[model samples]
Target: MAGIWAISCKPCELACVRQEVHARDAEAQLVRLASSDNVLSLIEADAGVLAGMLCSTSDLADDEAVSLIERVAKLVTCPLIVMCDRLDPGLIARLFYAGATEVVAGGSSSSCEPVSSKEACAKGALRQATSAGAVAHSKEPAKSASGMDAYAEPARQVHDRTAFHYASSMTTALDEPDGLDEPDELGRSDELEEPDEIDGLDEVASRKAMGGRSTSSEPGAPVICAIAGRGGVGTSSVVGLMAATAARMGLRTAVIDLDLMHGNLPALMGIDDPVDLARLLKDSDSVSETAIEATAMMVSPGLTLWGSLERPELAESMGTAVEQLIFALRDPADVIFIDTSVAWGDAVAAAVAMCDRCLVVGAPGPTQPESAARIAQLAARLGVARTKMVSVLNRCTASSLNEEFALRFEMALSLHSRVRIPDGGSEVSGLLSFGRLEDLARGESRLTSAIQTCTSSLLKELGCAVPEGFGKPSEQDSGGLRIRLPWDKAGEPR
Candidate 1:
C-alpha cells in the first residue's frame, strides 16, 4: 500500500500529522522522517510508493525548510505540502517558490487552537494532497502556474476551515517562460525577484531589511543583565544607554525588558505604543524567530527593543516565556542587554543566571550599598561569579559620602570592575522622561561621557572587538574640550 511521508523534528507535530493521515484514509500508511537525511533516502529508495509528503516548518528554520523543499522537489514525483504554524505570506511564497504543492497553517500544537482542532486542520490538508494528486507524473514537476492551480480548487473547499490555497495570482510573476531558475547551493537565487502583487510584500521587505535570520557559524551573542540594588538607581537608564551606545558603535543590539512588571524601556526609548509581549508569551510554544521579529520594534538603525508586559500582573507567569525570548534572540543580535527589575523573582533570577555579566547599579547612600550587598549575595546564589559582576555608582557627586558608598559597594561585592556616573541633575531625568535617549547619548556632558566610557569598557570585557575610534568625541566636541575623568579605566577604581 502507498504511504504518506511526513518530516518534523517535533514529536507533537509528527503525531498530529500521523493521526490526521490515519483518520482520513486508514489504508494509507504514515512514515515519519526524522531528519533531512532520511527524507532524501526515502525518496531515493521508493519515490513511487509515496502518495505525498508533509513538511512542517515548526522544527526547521525558514532557510532550512526552503532548502529542503527545493531539494525534494527536484527528485520526487509526489505532492509536497508545507505545514506552517502561522500564516506568514513571505514564508508561504517561498515554500511555493521552492515547489510546494500546497501550504497550510496550524499543523503544530503551538497554534492558538487545541490539539483536536490542529488535528482537524492537518486532516483536511492531508486529504487534499493525497486525493487531488496535486502534481503531475511527468519527469519534470509541472510549472507553478499550472501545478498550483490544479490543487487550489480542492484547497478552497477547506480554506475557511484549515488550508490556504495559492492560485496563479500568487505565482503568475514567478512563471517566466524560461521556467524557475535553479537556486544557488544556499537555496537562494543569485537574483531574488519578488512578485509585484504578493499580498505581504511589505512584511517581506522588512524581514529582508532586518537581515532576515542569522546563519552565523559563531556562537550566540553574550547576554548582559543589568539589575539595580534598589529602585531609582537608574538601572534601566544604564541599560538603555549601553544598548544605544552599542548600536551607535555599529553593533546589532537587542534590549529585553525582563522587568516584566512596570517595565519602562519603551517609555524611555520614546515608543508610544509598544508590542504586547505578554500576549505573545501566552503561547510560548508558538514563539519563533519570525514571531519575535514581528513583535520587536526597531528603535534605531541597529537597535531592536523587545518591550515588556503591558499588564503587570502577568509578570510572575512569564518566566518561561522570558527564557524562550532570550533563546530566540541569540541568532539575530550581536549582543543582548536585559534590564531586570529590583525584585528578585523567577524572571530576574533566570536573567542573572544566564547572563555573561551582571551589572549591579547602585547610588551613593548608606542603605543602597547594603542593598547592593544583598543583590550580590542573590547573584552568587544564582550562579554569577564575583569576577563576572560589575558594579556601577550612579548619581555620584564630588563628596566623601559618594566615595564611601562606592568603596562599600565594591568591597561588598568583591568586584574588580566599577563605573561611576556623575549626577546629570534634572536634565538627564527630563531627557529620559521624554524618551530622548538618543539626544542624551550624543550630548557633550559629564554624564554622557561617563555612560559612553562605561559602555566601551563593558563591550571590551565582553570580548567584542571594538571598532576604530569608538567612544571618541564627536565632531561637535572636536575643539579639544573633552575632559578625562579619574575612573576612565573601566575595571579600576580611583
Candidate 2:
C-alpha cells in the first residue's frame, strides 16, 4: 500500500481528491497537510509519496508553494508529485528541475496531450512541445523544442524511469477556515509523533547493562570536537552525522554549533530557533540544566542542539560562556559534539583544548595537509594527548587519493588518518544531508560500515567498551513496552 500526503489550501479540492484516491487505491493511506509551515515535521513523521495539489493557477504562483516544493525535493528523499489544473510546460520543467518526480493535470479543462511517440522514443528526452492549440492563446512563452534538449537527460534519467498518472475527476470544494497558525521555531506540530524505538533495544537498560556511567558527578560530558583544516570540506556535515549516530545509539547527545561566522547546523538539523548561544551566554549564572533545556531545541530522541549566534561580535565574549555551558550540560547529556569554526580562533582553540577527543577533517587538497599539521601543533601546545587526536579524510573515494591523504596526515600531523568518508553523491547531498546519511546508516552501505568502524574506534578511545553487536538490532524484545510518563511527551528529564 502506498501512502500519499496531499497539501492544498484549506477548503480546496484536495479533500475530495484525497477521498477518491483512498477509494481507488484501497491500500493507500492518505494524509492531508494542515499547514505549509510544518513541511519538515510532516516529512519526518510520514514515509511515502508527497502530492501537492494546486487547484487555481494563482496558487501555483504562490511563493510558499514553490518554496515548499523546493525544500521537500531537496530535504525529503521521497517521490514528490504535483497535481494541477493544466500542465504548464515551463512550470513543469522548473518543477522537475526543482526535484518533483511527476506532474499531473486535472480540473474542468483537462486537455493534457500525451507525449509524442517520436519524442518518447528519444533516450533521456524530457522537453515536450507546448500545446499548439490552447497554449498559443496562453501567456506562457512557447518552448517547442524537446524538453530534454535544455535539461540534462542523464541526470534526470533515474527519476524519469517511473510512470505518471493524471487525475481527471473533480471534487466539490470545502468551506475555507481561518489561516493556520505559524509553525513553532523548531517546526514541531501537535500532529507530529515520536518515532518507534530501534528494534526494541532498551536504550537505558542496555547502557546500564554495559555499565555506562552518568556524567552527573563530573563537570562536563565527553566532548568530540570536529575541526576542519579548511572550509567546505564537509567537516560540519561529519560532526552533525557523528552526533546523530551517537544519539541513535541512545547516548544523550548534544550538538553545539560553534561556527559563529557561517553556521548552518540549524538548517541541517531542521531547527528554526535553536538555542541562542549568545543570549544564553549573557548570564554567567544561567548555565544550569533548566536554562539549557529552556534554550536548546530537541531535534530527536536523545538529540539536542545549540545553534550559533547570528552576531559575530559575540564570539569574543563566548569563550568562557561556551566552556561554562559545556560543563553545565555534562549532567544532562552523555556526549557533546562541537562543530567548530573553520579558522583557528581563540574560541576554537579553547574548544579544542577542552575536548576529550578531536577529529581533524581535511579535504584531499593542496593546503589541507599543512592545515592538519597546524591543528596537530595547536593540540600539542594545548597539552592534548596524541592518542586522543584522530584525523579524517573527507570526500575522497579513489584509492590513490586516499593513500595520498594518509601519507599527508602522517607526514604533516604525525597521525595516520583512520576514517575516509566517500562523497555519497547527489542522492545524499542537501541542506538536510545529515538526515539522509543517518537513514543510509540504517542499511548496508560502505558509508554506514565506515561510520560504524569510526564510532567504535572513538568509543574505544574514550575507554568505553564496545558491545558485541553495536549499531545492530538487539535480540532482546521486551514485547513493546509503552508506559506514558508526564514528561514522555517532550522526552525531557524530570
Candidate 3:
C-alpha cells in the first residue's frame, strides 16, 4: 500500500503530519501511531506494507526518540524520517547514528511566532522516501566536512592513544587476542575456559556504560578545569571570579558550566535568561568556531559564558555533546575555565584529563581532604599528571585549625600549587544576593586578592601572556569596598 506512518504522542504534531502527507500525495494513506510500541508492533506484523515513517521528537524524550528510530530502522526497509521542533546538531547526530534517513526541523512544535516552512520540509521528507528504494542498499552513516563520521558515537571515537588502554580494560574476553590462548593436555585451546573475575571490573564496566574530550586541534586557549571535592565548596564561584579577573585584565576568557545537572553559572553571572545550550546545538549545522560563538553568552567585552543543559535528566546522555562544545571553544578565547560538579562521572573525568590545569577546590573541613585525595587518585587513573593539578582551599580563616586543614588538603591532593581564599563574611552573602559574585575579584578584600593571585599564577603557568598592568588595583579612587548589607536600605552601600 502507498501509505505513510505518522508516529507521535502529540495531537498537534500528528495533525500537522497528516496535513503535510495529504498535501504531498493525495492518494497516499496516512496511518497515525500514538506510541513507538504501536509502530513497532505494526512494523513487526507487516514490515513490507509500510512506505515510510515520519517520527516527531516533540512527544518523546531525546533518548526515547533515538531508541525508537534505531529499533524501527533495524526492522523496516522503508525510509525513517525524524521531525524535530528544532535541529540540534547533537540530537541530529544521535538520530542519524540510530539510522534515521533524514531529519527535518520546524514542525508544529516549533516555538517561533510563525511556524517555519512545514510544506517544504514535508515535501523534502516525501521526496527522500520516494528515492529510498534506489539507495536503500547503499545507505551509510553521514560524515562531516572534516571527513570524520559525524554520526559515530562520540564515546566510540578515541580522542588519543591513551584511550586504547581504557578501551582495552572494558573489552570483553571474546575480544582478546588468540595469542592469549594456550593448548591444554587434551590438545584443546584454553580459550573457552572461564577466566577469573578481576576486582573492580564490574564498576569499570558500569562507568563505561554511563559515558564521558580533547581541548582542540590547534594551539589555542589553555583549558582549566575547576572541580570541587564536594558540593557547596564554591568551585563555580572560584571559576567565575578567576575568569572574570583574567577578562578584566584584557584577556579573552570563557567559562563553561560542565555541571549539566544543577548548573548555576547563569545565576552567579547575573544573567537572568542565558542562551539554552541545546537550542544553540540545534541551530548550528556543525560544531565549528562560529557555532560555539553563537552558543556563548557574552557577559562582558572580554568574558563569555557557555551554559549547561535545560533538562537535568539529559545530563547522562550529554557527555559527548559537552566534549564537542569544549573542543569548539578552543580558538574562541585566550583562556577557558570549566566548572564541574562534585560527582565523579564520565564528563568530569574527561574534563579533568583534558585541561592544562586541574583546580581541585575544597572547603576547610576534616572530610574535604579525603574527598580531594580521592579526586586526585581518579584523575591520575584518567591520565592526568600530578604536576597539572592545583588545589584550592575555600572559606579559609586565619585560625590555627583552618591552617591545619589547608596543609592536610594540600598534602592529600599532593600538588605543588595551592591557593587559599578567605571567608568573605557578610560581604560575600550580599554579593551573592545581588548576583554579583564575579565582583569578588573587583575589590580589595582578601578574597579578591586570592582570586587575582590564583588567576595570575595559573595564567603564568600556562605561558599565557599576562597584560603589563595585570592584577594591579585600578587608580580610579582606590576607595574601600562598598557592598549593600541585608539590614541596610535598598540603594545604600556599606
CA lDDT, every prediction? 0.59, 0.50, 0.58
Give the clash count for model 3.
2
Query: Residue-wise lDDT of candidate 2 within 1-494, one digit each (tens)?
Result: 36454554334555444533432234555555556555557665653444322222224464555566666654543334454555454554455344443333433354322233122212212222211000111111122111111111111101121111111000110111311111121112222222232111121111111111122223224678888767877777788777777665656677888897678887777675656667766455434334444557667666778868778777766754565555445444556789988765555655665565678888767788888778765554442434346678766663346565657765676542356666555655752554454465455545555666677557544533345466442222112123557675578865
How many steric overlaps does candidate 2 have? Answer: 3
Which pairs, if any, clash in model 2?
127-146, 127-147, 127-148
RMSD (Cα, Å) of candidate 3? 25.1
Q: Could you give the candidate ranking by TM-score, starting with the highest?
A: 1, 3, 2
Report the C-alpha lDDT of model 3 over 147-206, residue by residue, as the tens digit: 111121122211222111111221331133431122221111222132332112222211
Name the best candidate (by lDDT). 1
Give the TM-score of each candidate.
Answer: 0.52, 0.49, 0.52
- In model 1, the runs with Cα more than 4 Å from the true position are 1-217, 282-286, 398-401, 472-494
Q: Which of 1 and 2 is the better model by TM-score?
A: 1
